[model samples]
Target: MEYFKKILRFAKPYRVYALLNILSNIFYALFATLAMISLFPMLAVLFKQTEPVFEKPIWNGISMGKEYLMEYLNYFVTQKSESGSPGDTLFFMVAIVITAFFLKNLFGYLAMYFITFLRNGVLKDLRNELYVKTVELPISYYSEKRKGDTIARITSDVLEIQHSFLSILELVVREPLTILFTIIAMLSISAKLTLFVFLFLPISGFLISLIGKSLKRKSDKVQKEQGYFLSILEETLGGLRVIKAFNAESRFSNTFKKSTKRFYNFSNSLLNRQNLASPTSEFFGIAAIGVILWYGGQMVLVEKTLKPELFITYMGLAYQILTPAKAISKASYGVKKGNAAAERVLEILETENPIAEIPNPIEKNTFESGIALEDISFKYGEEYVLKNFNLNVPKGGTVALVGQSGSGKSTIANLVTRFYDVNEGTIKIDDVDIKNLKKESLRGLMGLVTQDSILFNDSVKNNIGLGKKDATLEEIIEAAKIANAHDFITALPEGYDTNIGDSGNKLSGGQKQRLSIARAVLKNPPIMILDEATSALDTESERLVQDALEKMMRNRTSIVIAHRLSTIQNADTIVVLQKGEIIEQGSHTELISKKGAYQKLVEMQSMG
Candidate 1:
């Protein structure tokens, strides 16, 4: 219920709809009880049991409230029978009963009608917030998490919360109120019989609660298995090329099958338990009715203390409690199931992003002097990827970072972009600490083109203009020309308006990289970081992409992290890193003259 309360907070915005639902439910419950009670007067009229009365009954106080209501109804029946025939009295009684039932169904529909808006409204807001938080979180947050689990939270888990939340409102306001009104009517008919009914109800309620106790644990397994299989499915799609290339299709298929089989078992157990709720509750309801029949029989037939029509009406009211009781029991299990999903959904929504902005952050829009990495130490976990590292990149100059795979070339680009903050030191952009700068304003100063040319399934024009929202077609084409991507784009079907399929798979490696470069160029930021932007292409593709990079790098403060030494030979300064430390720094020619680590690397590459 702690989690239930937290999930309900999302429904706060839909209070008006919630209020309307509750208000409609109140009327529905009242009418539902009255519908059963209306049968009492009709039964009296049917059996010709009402004694004629000439005058109306007097109003009485609370202690005799039940007797007063009975007398008043009898007086009204007596007057109707006196003025007209017995058949006429019966017709009016049947009409009153019909009207009561009609109002009951009408308000019931209205309750659900208003609740629909509240339920769907909460779902929309929760999904929107989860997506926003997912995007705002640091890249490091995803490193240890599966994309599919997050996807499950945003999609299925939130859906669970929406359903569970609605069930809660029903349990709290509708079903319980219906049961309450029904019980009150039963008490009015026979207080002693009502007291007898309570004895069996508590026992049935306790047994129902016991059955639902393990439901949350089973539901957790079901939701977790769903996330697991979804992860496998997501991975299979993403790495289909690799799976096929390695001839491991059967392995992935078997893995997915195993997850689905688990899901099958978990769902069976969960739904079977949920299925038990209805029958179990109904059985207990019938059992209580049996007990009521035994006890109330003595009052009606043997004791000569109760009226036949009132006893029948009391039984009708007694049966009315069963429906809402069964509903509450069923929804209690749903709450358990929903609570499991709520925990998963709230876990993501309530996560604190480590890369949060400061209260008084400096909104730096311009990059003038340089980027400084002073005494910086950073790590993804325990072992530092960069330790006490330092560098200075001047304005309008090209600086290349070259290292082996684990030596931290890409780490430099990540730090400079503020994707991950340094552990022990301050990274200053134009002499202002990045920690003090607003994240949006800091990232706005730079453009990044990574090894993976990430592009959405969008048009070529939209992809190029992604960074600059208001960029005109002329600006887009001009940027594409500078990145050497204009000719191929013009040759594509529909030209700039052509749809690039998922991750831009419709284009070649070189074409994709050039589009990414064109995207950076369109942004026209002061600082450009190219982290192995041409590393994954064929020889021809690499050459075409490198030419685009060279053109775009002009008059920009550039940080080029590359492995192909030939590309960075003309860099204004070449910084060579190994094991998270810089062992050499100079122009390529000077590094060649050092006869050190950089020289040895160049010699080996030449041999290759």
Candidate 2:
């Protein structure tokens, strides 16, 4: 319920719809009760049991209103019957019943109509917030979490909340009011029988509560297992090439089948328990009705304390209570199921972003001097990835970082981009701490081109234009030409408009890399970070991409993390790293002369 209230805050924007639903439900409840109570006069007309009243009943105070209204109705019916045949009176009573039922259904439809907006509105807003948070959260957060699990929370679990929790909106107001009005009608017909109903109700309620006790826990397990299998499906789809290459399709399939089998068992358990709620409550309701029939029978037949027509109407109203009671029980189970989904969704919404920007952060928009990393130490968990690492890059000066895998070369790129903040020490840009800058403003001064290319399922033009929103067509062409991608792009069927397919699979490796460079060139930032950008390409592709990189790096401050030693020979400063520490820093010519780690790496690469 605590989580439910939190989710309800989203309903504030659509309060008008909620209010309309509540108002419609109120009228629906009134008509529902009145429709059942109309049965009394019809039965009197059918049985010819109505007593004729000689004088009109006078208007009385509120306390005796029920008695006065009944007398007045009987007087009216008697007068109508005296003027016409009994068949005419019977027809009038049927018309009244039909009219009452018509209004009841009309209001019921309106209630559902209004609630639809509120329910769907909450679903849309919740999904939008989840997407925003997914993009805003640090990349490190995903290192320990499953992508498919997050996808499940945003998609399936949110839908579960809509189906179950929002359904409570319909139940909380309509079901309870239906039961309330029905109970009131039952009491007016015969307080004694209504009191008899009270005796079994608490017992029935106790039993129903017992069934719902473990429903939430079981539902939680089912939702989690859903996420688990969805994670496996996402992983399997993303790595299908590897699975096929290794001939591991059967292994993954069996794993998926096992997960789905468990999900089936858990779901059956949950739904079966939910299914029991309906019959359990209905059985108790019918039991209460049976006891009323026996007890109320003695009063009408033997004791003569109740009228025959009124007793029949009282039985009808008593039965009416059962439907809403059954509904309330079922809705309680839904609430339990929905509560579990709500908890899962709120877990992501309520997660505190560790890399959150500070209040009133400095919005640095320009770079003048240089980037300085002084005495920085960082770690993913316990052991440090970079311990007391230090480096500097002057404005408009090209610096190259060379290292083996896990030597903290990429970590420097990550820190410079503020993807992960340093665990200790400070990174200053132009004599101001980079942490003080607004993240967007800080990132605005740099462009990144990774080894993967990272193209989306969009047009070739749109992929390149991602670096600079609303870039002109001419600008896109010029950027492509600079990256040596213009000729190949124009050769495609649709030229710049050619769709790239998934991850740009429609293009060659070199073509995709060149498009990535084109994107970075379009951004045209003062600082460029090339992260092993040519490592995955063939010699021909590397030569073309390297030429593009050199063209883009002119008059720009660049941090190049290179795998191929030959690419950085012309860099203004070459810094060689070994296990998070700088072993050498000089020009490529100077490093080759030193006969140290740099010279050894170059020799090893040349020999290979």
Candidate 3:
């Protein structure tokens, strides 16, 4: 319920729709009760049971209003039967019943109509917030979380909230009001019988509540299994090539089947429990009706304390209570299921981001001096990945980092971009601690191109334009020319308008890398970070991409993480790292002259 209330805040903007739904439901409840009560007058007329009335019934106070209204209705029926035909009196009573029923259904439709806006409005707002949070959260947040689970929260959990929580808007007012109004009508018919009805209600309610006790816990398991299986599906799709190449389809299939079987079991348990709600509540309702029949029979047939017509009407009103009671019972189960999903969704919404920007952070737009990692130490979890590591790249100069795997080259890029903060020491840009700078403004000062060219399923032009939101087509073409991608792009079926497919699979590796370089060139930032950008390409592709990289890095402050040392031989400075510490640093020629780790790595690659 706590999470339920938190989700309800999303509906505040559509309160007018909620208010209108409530208003319509009130009238619907009134008509629903009146429609049932109207049956009594018709029965009275058909059986010729109405008493004679010589004079008009007098106006009475609220307590005796029911008695006065009954007498007045009997008096009118008597007049109609006396003045016209008995058939006319029957027709008039039937018309009253039909009108009550018509109004009931009319307002019922209006109630549903008004609530549609509120339900969909909350859904749209909730999804929009989820998407914004997904993009705003630090990249490290995803390192330990499944992408599919996050997708499930935004998609499935939100739908559950709509099914369960938002639906409360319909059930909360209508069902309770229906039950309340019907109970009042029952009391007006026979207070003694109504009191007897109340005795059985609490017992039935308690029993029904017992069924829902374990529903939330079970529902939580079901939702989590749903995320688990979805994660498997996402992973399988993303790694289909590897699975086929290794001939490990059977392994992944068995794993997926196991998850699905668990999901099937959980879903069965949850839905079976939910299905039990309707029949259980209905059975209790019918049991209560049976008890009423026994007691009310004594009053009407044996004791003569109640009228036959009114006793029949009392039974009708009593049965009317069951519909709303059943509805409320089902809604209770829905709320339980919805509550579990809400908790999962709120977990993400309420998470505190460790990399949050400080208030009044400095907005740095220029790189006047250089980027410096001063005695920085960091770790992903337990052991340090970068321990007291330091490096400097002055403006308009390239500093290349060459190391084997896990040597913290990429960690430097992440820390400098504020993707993750250093556990100890500070990283400063132009001597200003990067922690003091606004993250967006700091990232705005640099361009990044990684080993895998990250392109989206969009047009070639749009992919390049991603570097600058409002980049013109001419700007895109000029940037492409600079990165040597303009010729291939124009040769495509639609040229700049060509769809790149998923992750730009439609283009070759080198073409994709060039587009990435072109995107960076379009941004034209003062600082560029290349993380083994040409390591994955073939010799020809590497040459072309290296040419593009050199063109883009000519006058920019660049930090190049090179897996192939030959690419950085002409760099202004080369730093060789081992494990997590820098072992050699100098110009490329000087490092080779030292006959150290850098020289050995170059010799090893040459032998390969």
> What TM-score would each prediction reach against the true structure?
0.97, 0.98, 0.98
Q: Residue 507 error for model 2, in Å? A: 1.2
After superposition on all CA atoms, what RMSD does each candidate show versus the true structure? 1.6, 1.3, 1.3
By summed lDDT, the worst window of 10 consecutive residues in model 2 runs over 60-69
Once fitted onto the true fold, the runs of candidate 3 whose alpha carbons sit more than 4 angstroms away are: none
Judged by lDDT relative to the true structure, which candidate is superior, 2 or 3? 3
lDDT tens digits by residue: candidate 1, 426-478: 89988999989998888899999999999999999999999999999999999
Each prediction's whole-model lDDT (CA): 0.89, 0.91, 0.92
Among all windows of 10 consecutive residues in model 3, the one with the lowest summed lDDT is 599-608
**Ten residues in a row with the worst lDDT in model 1?**
48-57
Q: Model 2's lDDT to the true fold? A: 0.91
**Candidate order, lDDT descending:** 3, 2, 1
Better of 1 and 3 by lDDT: 3
lDDT of 2 by residue, 437-514 (tens): 899988999999998889999999999999789899999999999999999999999999999999899999999999
**Model 1 ranges with Cα > 4 A deviation:** none
Model 2 clash tally, residue pairs? 0
